[model samples]
Target: MWHLAKAPDLADMEVMAHEMFALLPEGFRKLCEGLIIRVDDFPTDEVLEELQAETEFDLLGLFQGVGLPFQSGEVSGQMPNMIWLYRRPILDYWAEHDETLGHIVRHVLVHEIGHHFGLSDDDMEAIEAQVTDEAAEMPLGAPARSG
Candidate 1:
């Protein structure tokens, strides 16, 4: 199969991320209005330094911008919330793991979205569970990647 020949690139991963986000519950999606999703092959040098990552693969995804609970009307020049998906790290993870790429993408998206809401780990787990249950009802398919 052509899939065996190459890994999905940044654009391909972006499509997968957006599709997965669309599959999330409407309430959650509404809460995330104006959120942006972007995919890159690796994190920037600045990000690596900031996160103190030992390796580029140390992070699979990241959430940037202020969380809802921390926002203040007095604050100015705030940026929109964003979720970043790293394609190379995610692909490397997929190579080592048994789960489908769709599942991995969905999990990362949910985790990052949780950050936007400033949800605790337990709450995040509960949200993830809801996604898993919902996904079981209708499986999501990963988009095909083009070289």
Candidate 2:
């Protein structure tokens, strides 16, 4: 069984992210409406440069677009909010950490989404705890995919 295991690919991570998102508190999920979550092997060079990251793996995920507190109804032509998960970096972190893949993905998702909500680290940790409890109560099954 160990030999059969392989690292998750982009699509796999995307699905995991979606499933993790679905497990979040309903109110939290509601706040994330229209937010796009994407997974890539690594962040683009542009993103790395803009963030002043010394290496591609230095950043695990990123949240782009104005936070909720700064949004204005008058502003138009603004890009939709997006959260990017860097697969290679996330996987690398997973390898070095004791956490499960799902746990790592959920943590990164919460962290990035927290940025969108302008939430503090403490708030995000509370949300993560809520999600973990909710997931524990639910029967395990394959979650439906969503865009």
Model 1 Cα lDDT, one tens digit per residue, 1-147: 756666667776787788778767777778787899999988899999999999999889999987778777756677888999999999999999988787888889888888668777787667656555334233335442211
Using lDDT as the measure, which candidate wins? 2
Q: Candidate 2 — worst ten consecutive residues by lDDT sum?
A: 132-141
Alpha-carbon TM-score of each model against the true structure: 0.82, 0.89
Q: Which lDDT values do the candidates have, in the order given?
A: 0.78, 0.83
Taking all chains together, the TM-score of candidate 1 against the true structure is: 0.82
Give Cα distance to truth, residue 61, candidate 1, Å: 0.8
